[model samples]
Target: MLSRLAAPILGIPRPAKRVIVLAVDASLCVLTVWLAYYLRLGEWVKISGEGFWQPQWAVAGSLALALPIFIVNGFYRAIFRYSGLAALMTIIKAVAVYGLLYASIFTAVGLEGVPRTIGLIQPMLLLLTVGASRMLARFWLGGVYQNQLRMATLPRVLIYGAGNAGRQLAAAMANSHEMRVVGFMDDDDRLHGHVLNGLPIYSPADLPSLVSSLHIATVLLAIPSASRYRRNEMIQQMRRAHVEVRTLPSVSELAQGTVSTSDLRELDIDDLLGREPVNPNLLLLGKAIHGKVVLVTGAGGSIGSELCRQILAVGPVELVLVEQSEFALYEIHQELLGRVGEAPVILHPVLASVRDRHLMQDIMRRYRPDTVYHAAAYKHVPLVEHNPVEGIRNNTLGTLVAAEAAAAAGVADFVLISTDKAVRPTNIMGASKRLAEMTLQALSAAGSQTRYSMVRFGNVLGSSGSVVPKFRRQIQDGGPITLTHPEITRYFMTIPEAAQLVIQAGAMAKGGDVFVLDMGSPVKIRDLAVQMIELSGLCLKSPANPDGDIEIRITGLRPGEKLYEELLIGNNPSPTSHPRIMKAHEEFLPWPQLRARLDALETALDATDLDVVEALLTDLVAGFRCESDTPGWNGTATALAANHA
Candidate 1:
C-alpha cells in the first residue's frame, strides 16, 4: 500500500523530472564550493573579509554560472521513460557545459587562490552525484509502479535476449508485481555475468537448472528477429523443462518504438511444430483482388474455404462462393457474413458445381466475376483411383469447362488448384489433375483473354481427410492411429497459409503459368503421428509399454500412393515476388492437340473403356506414373465399369 502511494511521486513526469534534475545540479554546485573551501582552508572559515561576505559571493556566483548552462543544454527535456543511448549522450553534454561555466566563474571573481585541483574534483563529483540520483529515482519509481497493479499469481519469468528490445520490455514490467523477472537468458557468453538494469544475464544452457531452482512458471521469448524455426525449437526446449511459454511480437510490429506488456501473447500451439515462416508479397496479392469481384469454386472445402477467408482481407468488391455441398457452403457463408458485416462486398453462396456448365455459365453472366479461383475437384488419391471416371470427369473435364466459361465471360484471372501429386503422378487422381493443368495451359495459349494459372502444393495440415486430424481422432479413441507406411512423407502447410500463398500466386500469374508453393522439408507420416500423440501429453503404446496411451499401426500403402511427393514437373522453376512461391515453366500442347485428347477422353468415358481412358490420360499428362493395383483398386475399377455400362 505504501509503495502504491509512493509511485506517483517517484514516477516524476517530464515537467517534474526536469525540475528535479535542475535542482540537483544547482544544489551540487553549492555543495562542491563549500567542500572545496573547507578542505583548502583547514577550518570552517568565515567568508567575511573587511565586512564583505566573500564566501557568500562565491556560492552565489557558482549557482548563476551552472544553472543557465544546464538549462541551455536541454538536459531537462530527456524523458526518463524512453531513456537509453540518447539519454546517455545528453548527460555527457550537461557535464561538459557545467565544467566550463564553473571555471569561468572562479576566474571572474578573482578567487584564483583556490587550488586548481578543486576545479577538477568539483566536475567529477557533480556528474557522479547527479547521475547516481537519476538511477536511484528509476529504481524507486519502478518498484512503486509495479505495486499499483493487481497481479495474478503467475510464476516468476526470465526472458531471453537482453538487447534493446529485452531491456525495454523489462522496464515496462518494472511495476508488474504479478510476474517477477529473476534475470535474462541469452546465448552470448560475453553477456553472461553482466547485469542489465538490475537483472543478471544467465546462459541459455543453464535454463533447466534455473527453472528448477528459481521455480519459474514461464519463460518469455523476446527475440523478435529470431527465425520462426529457431523460435519453435527454443519454445519446445522450454516446454520440455516444464515451463509455460509466451512471446513478444515481431520487431516490425514494434517499429513505432514502444514495447508494452499488452503486446506479450501466449505462445500458440502451432509454434511447437518448428515450422518456417512465410514471407508474402502484399502488393501483388492486393493488385489482383483488391476491390474486384472475386469468385471461389468449391468454396466450402478446406482449400476453397480458406481462400475465401484470405481474399476477404484483400478488399474484394464481392466474394461469390460456389459450392455443391449445402452444409459446407452454408458454414463458410455464415462465417464470412459474420466477419465482413455490412461491407460492400456481396457474399453470395450458390449451390452449384463446375460440372454443371449451364449453371456455371448463368452465374458467370450474372455476376461477371473479375477473378475465379477453381478449387473444385475430386482430390483423394485412393478414392479417385477407385472411381477413375468421376475423377477424370470432375478434375479433367470440370477444369476444361471452368476455363472455357471464364474465357467467354472475360474474367481477368483463372487459377486452377493443382497438386504435387500431379508431378509425375502415381495415382489416377494426380493424372487427372495433370490433365486439367494441360487443359488450362492450352486454353490460355489459344487466345483466351483471362490469365490462366495453376497453384500446385501438397497436403495441408488439419484439412479434412488429412493424416493430422485422423491421427488426432484415433488418439482420442485410445487406440491405434493408422499410417499408410512408415516411409511415406509429404509436404505440409497450415490450410490458411497454403490458401494465402495460392491467392498471392494467382495474383502474380500471367498466361499459362504453374506456380508451386515452397512447402519446407516434408515430414514422415509415422513421425508426425508420433509427435501428435506425444504433444497431446500421451505415451505411445508398444511392446515396451503395454499400458501406453496410444498405439500406432502401420497399414500398407494404398494404390496410387508414393513414398514421397514432388512440387515441380521438370527443372528450372522461375521465382516469384514471394520466396515461398515458384512458377514452373513446362511445355504445353497446342489448342488443337489438347482438343483432340479431350474428345478421346470423353468417348472413352462414355464407352466405359477403362483401359482406353487410362491410356489417353497417360498420353496427355507428361511424366505420368501409377502404382500397381491393390485389392481396393481392382474392386473399384470393376464397379466403375459396371456402373458406366
Candidate 2:
C-alpha cells in the first residue's frame, strides 16, 4: 500500500512536489506557533483576548519569518526522499537564523503583539517537526523502510577488510538494492569478533562457517594496499568457501581515495600469480632510451606498443613506430601524441613490413635511431604453425633485414624481442623466433657497430588472442570457458612490466647477450580458468556441481602447442644486476656459416620449395619437432622431395 501511494507521488511533477512540501511546511509553522503559545501560558490561549500581544499575531509573525527563511536558505530545493544529513543541517541552520530574528523582534527588543518566550519555543518545535517529516518521507518514498521487508532475499556479501576502504564500501552498498553486506572478514585477529558500521568482523578462519550461516554469495576484497601475496591467500580462502570474489583496484589505481560499487572489479589473473615485480634499474632503463631516437618494429602489437609507451616515458627525443598494419600504426601514433603533453618527443608512424630490407634500411637511415627494438614477428603458435611459410619469412628473415638495416644506420643498441617459445621449439612460430635470435647472435658476433641483444620471456597477460580477455568474454557471455588442455601451463607477466624489463635488459646487454626474464612460476591453464570463473562470481559447471554457472570444455591441445614452456634452453643461466633478469650462455652458429644457410633458405623460400624449407628449419633450429597431426603440415617434405625428383 505504501509503495502504491509512493509510486504516484514519485511520478508527480517536480514543481508540484515542491509546492506540496511548501504548503505542508506552512501548516507546520502555524501549528507550532499555536502550541508554543498554549505551552507558555499553561492553558488554552485565545488569540483575540489580549491587549497588544496576542496568539493570533504570534502565528502570523511565525509563518512570515520561518517560511521565507526556509525558502531563502534553499530548504525547498531538497528532495525529501533524497535528503541526507547535509540537507538536515541546512534546515537547522535556516531555523537558527529565523529563531534569532524572531527573538530580536519579540524578546530582545519589543513586539507589540508577540510574547518574547514564543520566539524560542516556537522555533524549537518547528525544528523537531520539520526534521521528523523529512525522515518519514525518506523512509516512505525512498523505500528504505520497505527494503527491510525483503532484506533476506538480497544477495549477501562479506568484505575482506576492516579498513577505511571496506567501511566506505559498506556505506556505499547500504543504498544499493542489489546486494547486502553482512560482515567483514579481516586477517587482523584484533579486529575479529568486533562490530564495525553495524556489521560483524569475523576472522578469515571462520569464513566457511560464516558463509554457511550468513549465506554469503560473494566476497569483495577491499584491501587495495595489501600485497599481492596476501590477496592471493584471501582469494584462496574465498575459493575454498565456494563464494565469488571481486577486488578493488590497486592503491596506485585508486587515486580518488574512495570505494564504491563501480570501483569493484573482477579479481585480476595477476593477483593469482602472487609474483611481486622487481623495480627496474633506472640507469639501465634510460641508458639507451633517454634523449635518443628510438624505433620499435611491430609497434602496434602488444609488447611492441608497451615498449613504445615506456620508451616515450624515458624521454626519447623521437620515437618511430614501424608496423605492417595501417590501423595499428595510426592508433599508437595518436595515443602517443596524446601522451606527449608539452614533451618535445616527436612521433613517426611508418607503415612497412620488416621483410622489405630496402624500405627498412631507408627508414633506419632516415631516422638514424639510437636504439631499435625489433618486436615485429609472428608469435602465435597454432596460427604460425598452420601458415609456416609466411611465419618463417616474417619471424626469421625479417629479423635479418631489420638487424642489417640497424647496423648500417649505426644504431647504438638493437634489441630483439624474443620469446620463451623460441627455446627448444616445437612449432613453426617457435622455430622461426629461435632462428631470429640466432640471426641477432650471428650479427653481433660478425662485429657490427651496433650492440645486438635478445630479451626472451613467456606469455604476457591481456595480449591480443591471449586467454585472459578470451576467458573474460566467455564469462560475460555466460557459458563454457574453452581450455586448450587441462594440464598445459605457461608463465604470465603484465605487459607494462615485461616491456620495462625488456628495455632494462637491452640497456644492460653486452654484444650477443641473451637476457631471459625470471618468469616466476608456471600457472596451470585449468586452475587459471577456474579462478577467472570464481572471481567473476560464477561457479564451474561439472559433475561435482551440475547446477554451476559455467562449464569448462577441454578441446585438447592445439597443433605444436607445448604442455609447458621454458625460459632457458641451456643450463646454468647467469644472474644479472637486476634480480628478475638472467643472461643465458646459449650457443649459436657463426655468422659466415649461418649466412650461407640463410641464403639457401631464402632461395628455397623464393622457389616455394616446402621440402628444403622444412629440412633447413629442422636442421637450423635445434630441438624443433613438428607435430604430425597438424593439418597441411604432415608429409610436406616427402611430397615436395618427390615432386623435385
Candidate 3:
C-alpha cells in the first residue's frame, strides 16, 4: 500500500513528483495541527471555558504557522530513495523549526485557556510522526514494491559466519531476487540467540535442524578471515548436511568493503582439505623470469605444465616449450595459448629430446633463452630400476647435454628439476638424478655465464603417476586399491602450488644453488587412501568385512621404493625470503674431477656396462645407497639395446 502511494511520489514524472511532494507536506502539517488540538482538547467537541480550544481560531492559527514553516524548510523537496544522512538532518531541522513556529503562534494568541503543558507534546509528536514516516518509506515501502514485482521469491540461504562479514552479506542480499537469507550459523556461543539484520544467529551444531526446517538449499560461508583449517572443518560439516556451499573470496578481494554476489564463488576442491597458506617471494619470482626468454623442458608433463603456467604469469618475455611427446606438448601449448592471449611474448614449441646434444645446442643458440627449466628426466622408480641403462642415459646424460648447451649458449640461468629420492639414493632413478645435480654443479663452476640451480621437492597430488589418482581409479573400478606398504608415507602438495614455489625459488637462485621446498609433514599412504575412500562416500573392504565397498591390499614394496623420502642431503640449509624455500649447501666435486667422472660414466652407459655404471654412480653420488639386492646387470642389456636401436 505504501509502495502504491510512493510510485506517484517518485515516478510520476518530475513535475508530478514536485506537486505530490507539496500535497504530502501540506497534509502532514494539517495532521500535526489536528493531532496537537485533539491531544489538548480531548475531543472534537469544544472544551467549555477554553478559548484556545475554539475550533475556528485553533485550526486557522495552526495552519497559518505550520504551512509557511514546512515550505521554507524544503521538508518535502528531496527524493526519498536517495535520502540518507542529509535527509535525516533535514527532517530534524524541519521538526525543530515547526516546534518553534507552533510555540510562537500559541504565545501571540495569548495562552489564556491553552495549557503550557500541551505545547510540550507537540514537538515529540511531530518528531515521532516525521521520523516514522521516512523510515517506513526507506525500508518498508521499497521492500513492498520489490515484493510486488516478484523480487521476494528467492531461495532461502543460511550463512555460516555471524561476524561482520556475515552481517554485511545479509544487508547485500536484502533486495536480491535469487537468494534470501534465513539466518546465520557460527561457532561462537556468545553470538548464539543474537539477532543481526533481523536474522537469528545459531551455533553450527544446529545447522542440520535449521537447514531441514527452513528448507535451505544454499549456504554462504562468510568467514573470509577464518583460517583454512577452520574453513575446511566448516565445509565438511556443511557437506554432511547436504547443503550446497559457496563462499566469499578472501578479505583482500573485497575492494568495495562489502561482499557482493559476484564476489562469492563455489567452494574449490582444494578447500575441502586443510591446506596451509604458502608465502612465496614475488621479487624472487620476478627477478628469475621477468623479461627473460624462459624454456621449460618436458613442458607438457604434470609438473612441467604447471611450471609453464606460473612462468607465463610472472611476465616472461618468451616461453620456449621443449618436449618430445606430441600430445603432451600440444596440451600445454594450447593451455598457455588460451591464457596468455595476444601478449607479445613469443611461444616457441620445439619438439626435441634433451639427449640430442646438437638439437639442444641448436635450440638454445637459436632462441638464446635466458632461463632453462630442465624437467625432462624419466622419474618412475621401479620402471627406471628395470630399465637402468635407459634411465641413466636420459636422466643423467640428458641433463648433462642440456647443461652443457646452456653454458655454451651463455644462458643467464639454468634450473634442473630434481627429486627428493636423489638424497641417500636407493634406486637407479634417484642415482641418475643425483648425477644430474652433480653435473649442474660441475658446469656452474666451470662456466661464467649461466647460473645453475636445482629445485627439489616430493610427490605432488593428482600428478600423472602419483598414488592418489591410482587409488581413485582403483576405487572407481570397484576392486582392491593397491598399496605398497601400510607404513609407507610421502609428502604431498597440489601440483600447481608446488610449481609456483619452484618458479619463485628459481628466481632466488645463485650459482649452483640447490633449493628445497618445505613439503609439509609426510602423510601415511594407507591413511590417505582411507580418507579418499571415505570422502568418496564408501567404506573400505577388508577380510573381516568382505561386503565392504573397496578392498585395500598390500603389495610389498617395489624394488627401488622407499618407505619415506628426505628433502635435504646435508644439515646446512639457508633460509630465504620465502619461508617454504630453502637453499641447501652441499659439497660438489671440482669441475675437472666431475668432468672426468661424467666422461667415464657416459662411456659405461653407452657400452651397457650395468655393473660398471652402478659402481660409478655410487662412487659419484655421495651418501648414495642401493636398496635392491638384485643382480646388477639384470635389466641393463635389454634397456641399452633398445636405446641404441
Say which candidate scores most in TM-score.
Answer: 2
Residue-level lDDT tens digits of model 1 in 60-96:
7667766776667665666354234565566667777
Give per-model CA RMSD.
17.3, 11.1, 15.6
- Report clash pairs, candidate 1: 146-175
What TM-score against the true fold does each predicted structure earn? 0.63, 0.76, 0.64
lDDT leader: 2
lDDT of 3 at 570: 91
Clashing pairs in 2: none
**What digit string (tens of lDDT, one per residue) describes model 3 on residues 396-483?**
8999899889889988888999999998888989989988898888777775578899999988877878876687788779858999
Model 2 over residues 408-430: C-alpha lDDT tens digits? 99999999999999988888899
RMSD of 2: 11.1
Instruction: Please give the clash total of every predicted structure, in order.
Output: 1, 0, 1
lDDT of each: 0.79, 0.87, 0.78
Question: Which regions of candidate 2 deviate over 4 angstroms?
Answer: 1-154, 544-547, 637-645
